[model samples]
Every structure is written in C-alpha cells, then in structure tokens.
Target: MRYFLIPALTAFLAAQTIRVGVDLVSVPVLVLSREGRVVPDLQPADFHLFDNDVPQAFVLDTSVSPLSVAIVVQANQDVRAYLPFIAKIGNAVDALLIGEAGEAAAVVYGDEVTVAKPFESGDLSLALRKLAPDGRNARAIDAGMRAIDLLRARASNHRRVLLYIGQPADHGSESPLDELRDAAETYNVTIHAVALPEIGKTFVSDTFSLQGLSSRSDRGGFKAGTDLGRLIPTVARTAAAAQSADPFSVLAAATGGTQLHFREQKQLEDAVAILGIELHSDYVLSFTPKGTGYHTLRVEVDVPGAKTHARPGYRLTTN
Candidate 1:
C-alpha cells in the first residue's frame, strides 16, 4: 500500500476536535454527466468505496437535513468601494437559504476573520445586508481556515458547507496553504468559492496600454527607455494581479466543492441560484475505514460518460 502523509498532522490534531473513528468517514459526492447536467440517481452499487485503494462497503445518506453553511466574505477597500454598484448580496443569500431548516453564518474577513453573525436557522438576508467592509487588507486564506474550524465544531448532523465570496487573494494569513488543505480534509468541510473580481478598477498597465504601450513595445513608449515613475505602479499592479489569481481552488478541489467565477453581478446572482439547487442534490456516503491516517476515496458512477465530482479523500486524526 502507498502511504501519502500530510505534514503537520499532530499540530492539526491538537488544534481542533477533528472527526474520526471507523464510522465517521462521511463523503459527500456530486455526480455529473459529460454534458454538464447533475446525475442524481446513482445507487450504492454504482459507487466503489475504497480506503487506501482497499474496496469496502458503504451506505449513502441522501437525507434532506438542514444545511450548515458559513458565508465567508472578503471586505477589503477595493471590494467595498464597488459594493454599492454591485447587486444586493441579500438576493444571493436568500437563494442559498431557501428551505425552512437552512442555517447560515456571516463571516467577513479583512486583516482578520470576524464572525459578524454566527450560525442561525433564521433568514440571513438582513444580517448580510447590514454587513460592511472593515480593515485595509484581506486574509482569505486565514478566514478559510477559521471557517472550516467553525463548521467542524458545529453540533449538527446536517451536511456542512462553506460559501466563500471574495477576491481570490490572501494578503496576510496565519495559516499556510498546505495546512489549510489538511484542515479541510480533517473536518470533511466542502468549500464552494465564488470569485468576486473588482469591476472598472484602474491600474498602471491599463493606463499604459490605453496610451499605445503594447507588449510588443519593448521600451513601453518611454523616451528614456524606461520610466522610473512607472516602475512602482507597474510592480504594484503585477503583484495585485498575481495575488488575485485563484487561490482557493486547491481547497475547493480537495473538499469536493465547485468554484464559480462571475463576469457580471447578475451572473453572480444566477450562480447562487444554481448553487441552491446543487446543495440540496448532494449524496452523502458514510463508510467505516479499517484504520486511521489519510484515506483515499474514489466515487464513480456506473453510467458511461458520467464524471464524479467529490473531495479527493479525507484525513482522519488518530491518536
């Protein structure tokens, strides 16, 4: 057997009460076809459960229990600047919490993670509406770690999910990416990220490109061959762009979650609507692992041309 171990396993165990034991290996799976439609009717026989490549028997839990969702929002200055122009997130929040048993927590992140509103079974639109941006920096990576911790500790049997809405950047985070990946697997938390890009934001490159400075222009149209004045702005823009690239996809992929990107505010609203349906359509699989440590989970549909989207596997903390 090939053993793949994650670093810092002991530290992760010391931090939180991670789900373990032979019976707690619950895997949530989403079945989809090649044409992008959700395949909802798959039986236990369709799935081949494995713990470290060893086949095992498992049961499917497609219960319609109340969903435990943490809405982690990024509230940096730039995102807050265009907040008014964007469509009301309340509509999106409303779409997610459609059922009577739906519960949600509103967490806003900047330099630090703040649970603006803890999990509540009531409607979250009002609380989300009242939320505003704070601090100068964004710490999406750190906030994500905190979100997973919150969902794991929640005293509910309902399916746990994290809805991250923010620009894909981590300015200052106490946790590293590897640790975050471990945390997600440790808790079996599913993360669905919605990338919120700034609209109409001005940058040095935008200005230079507007003035006939193309990539083909080696000197960037500077008479001195290089404008010292543009250096800082150019570097700043480059760093910002690099940071804005998708940082949460790995966590999403590891957690068997989907990542949605929006071009328009309306598209965000529509995506949220679609997510509402997907949440209710998931199938939860519970299996008893033979032992502890990290286990690989592969869920496939017997149907031809069907793709399965699920977390790679889970890491059970064993003493």
Candidate 2:
C-alpha cells in the first residue's frame, strides 16, 4: 500500500476565482515528437482541452512571451565533492536565457536555502560564483518549494518556470511533496528538473549497493549462503535512502515539467541545449474553469504521433 504525505489530488486542486473581469486559466504546453524534438506552428483548433472532464472553450497563445525562471541548486556534502561538475552549471544558465526578455534568479539549498541572486537579465557570473556547495543537510524538496513560492510572488506576468539542478534526494526537508505540488499548481509554475546523480555518488552508490546486497541475501539465502540477520538490518537502515532517487521526477511530471537524468558531464550540456530550444517553443492556452472546484486538465493534439506535455491541473479557489 502507498501513502502520500499530501492528499495528492486535493492539494493540487485549490479553488481559484475569476480575476477582475476575466475567468481565463492560462496553461503552457509543449508539443514534442517521439524523437524529443519540439513541434512548432500548431493551430488552436488542433488542441482539445477538458477542464474537470468537461469540454471548455479555449484559445491558444503561441506568441513568444518573456520568461521568469528560478534556478534551484542543491548544496550538500555530496554535491560539494562534485564542485568541478557543478561549476559547469554557469554555462547552462546562458543556454536557459534564450528569449530577448528572459530573466533569472538563483537559489542555493544548503543548511538553509538562500536566494543567491535576484532576477536579472544580464550575466550571472557573480551569482554563480557565490553558489558553493557546503551543507550537510540538503533540503532539496523544501528549497524547491520555497523557490516556487518566491517565483510565484515575483514572476506573475511572465511565464514562470523553475530549473532545479541537483540530486532528487532530500535529507532534511520541512516542506512535503503535497504542499510543493499545491504551490506549483496555485502559481502555475512549471518545473524542469536536471538530476545530477554523479554529484550524490557516494549516497546513491553506497546506499543502493547495500540495498542490492540485502535483496540478494533474502532471495538467494540458500544458494548464496549469506547471513540474513546482518542483511536485514542493512536493508532497514538504507530504506529511506532508496526513496531519494525519485522525488524530483515525480514533482516534474506533476507540474508538467521534464526530468533529465545525466550520467556524464557532456550529457548535461546536451540536455540543456534541447531544453533551451523547448523552453522557447511552448504553446500557452487560456481556458476558464467550469466551476469553483478541483479541476483536472487534459491537452490533446491532432498531430499524428505527436505528444503534448502540460500540467495535469490546477486548483480553482472560491475567493
């Protein structure tokens, strides 16, 4: 049986009211081919959107809008060991700011999360320099939630997106996944997670190795002739660590964001290149929710073999 910290659907489905004289909900969607290439020039009629499972009136906004991006970097001991690789993140920022009016902010998650740089359009050399990894407790989930909240407050007009650069593991997080999902939907913030498994090598490699040994000992006790007594304790201790590899991926999917896992430094660079192009080529749709209840969203395109990716839904507040 699986249990979630936050009521998954309810947390994301906050009630939202029609603002001012408008009752439009804006959704940004990415249309990609099976090969991961962005498909452009999609017409409004090509899309069919359902709000709370009800067909809704909608329009597509394909104009190149300015972007407000929040970059979240994890700063834990394991990440610190891979500083040389983390330093390359500076180049990724350059690739991220593709639009003429794109602006970005950086947040570092260590013992405590800190806003390393306020939103700016110019060079990010100084801010990147200040983001050194050092903390023992890397509250990745908490820091990510705070970063989303900050982006929610500061970047309302622009297309808001969070670029999370770290391992999926959260050692000490005050904010739970449910709250984070709620905030992401409430603010219409899209998350793009770049998982650096190499940075947290010690934790991932060692912890999982123990888990594998424990599993083998259990399954092949007779043939392998391993001690079940010692292995059971090892499995119990490393159980929490096993869950660390999947949180960011889940967060990304829930918020209509993409998760890229990189094994080599070059893979990260290549993934960033594709992401930069995809970021500039999203379709924004506006639709009004049917009622002031929890609403689910679905986007379908008429293009053959084309896939559409967007947020699952948002909360409609009765304010």
Deviating ranges (above 4 Å) for candidate 1: 1-22, 85-87, 120-123, 198-245
Clashing pairs in 1: 256-311
- Kindly provide the TM-score of model 2 when superposed on the true structure, using C-alpha atoms: 0.74
lDDT of 2 by residue, 1-319 (tens): 0112113211211111111112467777766554334455568788888887777778776544567778888876777755556566564555344333567878888788888777744355567666676668878878887788678666445777888878777878898877777777777777787777744254321111111112232221111112212111110113342234577765665667766656555555545544554465567788766566557788888877666777777777666
For all candidates in order, the CA lDDT equals 0.59, 0.60
Cα RMSD of predicted structure 1: 16.0
Best by lDDT: 2
Best by TM-score: 2
RMSD, each candidate, Å?
16.0, 14.6
Supply every candidate's count of residue pairs whose N, Cα or C atoms clash at under 3 angstroms: 1, 6
TM-score of each: 0.73, 0.74
